[model samples]
Target: MAKFAVIGHKGRMGQALATAIEEAGHEFCVGIDLGGDPAPVIGQCDVVVDFSSPDALVGNVKAARSKGVPILIGTTGLEEAHFSAIDEAARDIPILQTGNTSLGITLLSALVKQAAERLGDDWDIEVLEMHHRMKVDAPSGTAKLLGEAAAEGRGVALDDKMDSGRHGQTGARTPGDIGFATLRGGTVAGDHSVIFAGNEERLTLAHSAENRMIFARGAVRAGGWLIGKPPARYTMHDVLDL
Candidate 1:
C-alpha cells in the first residue's frame, strides 16, 4: 500500500504505468507529465517512479532527493555524468536506475555474460537491436549493457572494442571488435539479440519486449522495493535479488 508518484505521465509508457498503478489498487499519489514538477502532488509519497525524458530526469532526481523519497529512474540515453549525480545522491537515498527494466532483460544479461565467457575471445560477437520508430538513441543502451557483459567476460574493454554499423563492404571482421546493428520501425516494443559467430556454429541470445509493461511494471516494483532500503544505488538485478 505504498503511495506512488509517476513522473512523465504524458508519455505512452508513463500513462500506461499510471493506469497500472491505479488498477493494482496501490494509490496513485501524484502524476506529473510535461507540465510541471510532481513535487507538490507527490509531497508525501513513499517513492517516486520516473519514466520521463533524459533531460528532465536530473531535476526530478534532485526533487526526490529534496523530499527524502527513494527514486526509480527508467529514462534511457543518459550520460555517465547523470549516473554520477545519482551516485552522489545515493549517499543519502536509494536511487535505482536501469536502461531497460524488464526482469527478462536482467536474466538475458546474465546469460550473455556466461555465453561470452564460455565462447572465449575467438568468437566474434555482434549485437542487433530493433525498436519502435520514436526512440531517439541509435544503439539501445540495453545493447551496450549486453556488450559490456560480453566484453567483461572476454577480458576486454567495451569502449575500446565496440564497433557500430559497418559499411561499404568492410573487409574481414575484426576478431576483438564487437559490432552493433540497430533497426527502427513500426510499433515494435523492443528486440535485442547477441550473436556469437565462430567456427562450426553460431549462437544467438535474444529477448523481445512485446509490451512496455514489462519495463513499467518492473519499475513500479523497483520503486516499491527501493523506498524501504537505506541509501544506495542499485540496478534491476538488485531489485530482482540476483
Candidate 2:
C-alpha cells in the first residue's frame, strides 16, 4: 500500500478521505495542518493529498516538490499565479488537479463538451450549481468546469465568454454566452445541471451527489492510482481513463 499524507486533515473532506483511505486498506501515514513544516511525517509520505484552502495550497505544493512527493490537489478557487506555480512544479513531479473528484462529474464534463459541439451556436448554454453553505467558492468548481466544456464546444476560450449570473434588467442573452448560477444553503452535497436552451426545446444534463462519500472515494482512488506515475500533469480523465 502507498503511504499518503493528507493536508487539512481536520477539515471535512479531508477527514472523510482519511477514513475512506483506511477502509480501502491503504496507508495514511500523516495528517498535516496549518502549522509550520510538515516535514516529520508529510515529508516522508509517498503522496500528498490536498483539500485545503486556495491560499494554503501553494506552500503545500512547494513542500511536496521539495520532498519529491507527488501531489493531488482538490482545492478550488485557484488563480493565474497559482496555476503558474503548479505548472512550474509539475516540471519535476507529477501533479494531478481537479475541481471535482466524483467519477460522474468528469464523465458529465465529457458529455457537456460533446453536446456543446453538437448544439453549436443555436443553443444558449447556462450552468446551475448548488452546494452546502460552507463552500467557499461561488459558482462551484464543478460549474466552472462545465462552463469550460461549454466554451470548448463552441470553439471559444472560457475567459472570453463567461457571464457570471447576470443581475436585474439584463438584456437579451448574447450569442456564445456561457452563464452560471449558484445556490448555497443547508447540507446539500452537490448538484449541477447544464441547460442548453433552443427555440423549440431545452436539453438538460444533471448530476446530484447524494452523499459526500463518493467524492472521498474518488479522491482516495486517485491518490492510490497515481502513487508512482511519471512526472506529468494529470486530470480526472487521466485518472479514470475516460
Candidate 3:
C-alpha cells in the first residue's frame, strides 16, 4: 500500500484526509501542520497531499521536490506567485493542483466548458458559490475553476472578462462577461451553480457538496493516481481521466 503524507494536519480538511487515507487502505506516513517542517518526513511518503494555507505552499512544494515525491495541492486562495512555485517544482516532480477535488466538480467543469462553447455570446454566464463561514476566500476556488472552464470554451482570458464584487452605481452588464456571486454561512460544505441566461430561457448547472468526506475521498484517490507518474503539472481532470 502507498504511504501518504498530509499537510495542514490540524485543519478540517486535513483531519478528513487522515480518515480518507486510512479508509483507502493506504498508510498515513506523516502529517505536517503550521510551523511544522515536512522535509523531515517527505522521503517516507509515496505522495503528499497539501490542504494547508497559502503561506506554507512554497516550502511544502520544495520539500516534496527534494524527496522526489509527487504532490497533490488542494489549497485554495493561491496567488500567481504560488502557481509559479508549483510550475517550477513540477519540472522535477509530478504536481497536481486544483481548487476543488470533488469528482463531481471535475465533470461539472467539463460540462460548463461544453455549454459555453455551444452557447452564443447572447447568453450571459454567472457563477454562484457558497461555503462555510470560516472559509476566508471570496468567490470560492471552485467558482473560479468553473469560470476558467467557461473562459476556455469561449477562447478568452478569464481575467479580462471576469466581473465580480458588483455594488453601487454599477452600470449595465457587459456582454460576454462572466459574473460571480459568493455566499458565506454556517457549516456549509459547499454549493456551486453556473447560470447561462439567454433572451427567453435560462439554464443552470449546479453541484452541492453534502460533506467534506467527498473532497477528502477525491484527494486520496488523486494522490494514489499521481504516484510514479512523470514529472509535470496536473489537474483533477487528469486524475479522473476526463
User: How big is the positional error of residue 190 in model 1, measured in Å on the Cα after superposition?
Assistant: 0.5
User: What does candidate 3's lDDT look like per residue over 97-198, in tens digits?
Assistant: 999999999999999999999999999999999998999998888999999999999999999999997999999999999999999999999999999999
Worst 10 residues of 1 by lDDT: 34-43
The deviation in Å at residue 130 for candidate 3 is 0.7
lDDT of 2 by residue, 1-242 (tens): 87879998888888898898898898889898877566556767888899988888888888888888899998999898889989998988899998899999989999999999987597999999999998888888889989998888889999899999689989988788899999999999999999999999999999999988888888888988877888888888898687
Model 1 per-residue lDDT tens digits across residues 16-45: 788777766677888888869766666689
Give the Å shift of residue 209 in candidate 2: 1.0
Model 1 / residue 231 / CA error / Å: 0.8
lDDT of 2 at 81: 83
Worst 10 residues of 2 by lDDT: 35-44
Inter-residue clash pairs, candidate 3: none
Instruction: Choose 1 or 3, whichever is better by TM-score.
Output: 3
TM-score of 2: 0.96
TM-score of each: 0.94, 0.96, 0.99
Off by over 4 Å in 2: none
Which is the leading candidate under lDDT? 3
For residue 176, give model 1's deviation from the true position in Å.
Answer: 1.8
What ranges in model 1 sit over 4 Å off?
A: none
* Candidate 3 deviant stretches above 4 angstroms: none
